[model samples]
Target: CLGDRAAVALSRAGHFRGRTLFSGMLYAPLVMPEVITGLSLLLLFVAISAERGFWTVVVAHTTLTMCFVAVVVQSRLHALDRSIEEAAMDLGCSPVAAFLRATVPLIWPAIAAGWMLAFALSLDDLVIASFTTGPGSTTLPIRIYSEVRLGVKPEINAICTLIIAAVTVLIVVASLAAKLSKTQADNAAPM
Candidate 1:
């Protein structure tokens, strides 16, 4: 939520500050290894004298995933036609009102997609979570890794299978939702 809102607000601000700096930050996480991101975030936490706990893990995950969300949202924004918002404004809506009413509906699918991506990344993340998480904050990926370190068992396989099935269902649902949104957007367009 924060990532999408921040990206759109920055993009709306102007060219240089928005396009260059935010774009660079977003791509930096993509290129950097997960270990490096984890280490850097750990260092940041240490510097701030913050305790490693659930909220710390949440913050670290958000920081790492927001860049990905920003990139996805930004690409969608770029592909979005500005003319729609302009037409809304011409119809007597304020700029903010036009963006909220005319623009948001069109790009909502992309936002949802980015949010889901961020969520999935956070879900399976072990490296970063290891560096940032404290006792009692163990995530599913960490648990799976631990189980894998022991010999893989039938129960583990069953659990893995269930996770795969869940992820598959999520993907199918998201795809259908995106397609529905696209159809609605098409229907709403002026002839």
Candidate 2:
């Protein structure tokens, strides 16, 4: 969340050397191979002497997810109207207050989409989790892979189908809710 917000702030700033540098660094992770990311994370844990476990997996996934969120939010920020934030500040709102009251509410759909993308990526991740996970810290993807190695089971297909359906339903519901709220707000607005 912080990364996404920071990306928006930085991207909104006028073009500069530092912004260019930050954008390069931010997008670099997206192009990096999963194997390299996994290996690098494993090394970092080993170097720090941090115990590899659930938290480590969580950290690794969060790192990966942040990059994705940053991308989504940046694009949204680019298409946003800067005048709204300026108007808020001109109307006596502080810079921080302007962000919270004007910017955030308008860009909420993008933030939500980014969050959902991050969640789905984390859920489907296997390569990074494999490197970061300790014994007994297996994820669903890992478990499914292991099961596939033994033999493909019909029940596994059913479970995968159910998971896909659940995710699809969640996405549909969220979209419908967002649309309903927008319609309500529009109806309540004065001409």
Clashes of each: 0, 0
In candidate 1, residue 165 scores what lDDT? 100
- Model 1 scores a C-alpha lDDT of 0.86
The worst-scoring run of ten residues by lDDT in candidate 1 lies at 9-18
| Strongest candidate by TM-score | 2
Candidate 1 C-alpha lDDT tens digits along 1-191: 87787679666767664567666776687888999999999999999998888888998898889888887887788889999999999999999999999988988878988988999899889999999988777878887888889989888899889989999998898789879988999999999
Query: Deviation in angstroms for 130 in model 2?
Result: 0.7
Clashing pairs in 1: none
TM-score of each: 0.84, 0.86
Q: Which lDDT values do the candidates have, in the order given?
A: 0.86, 0.87
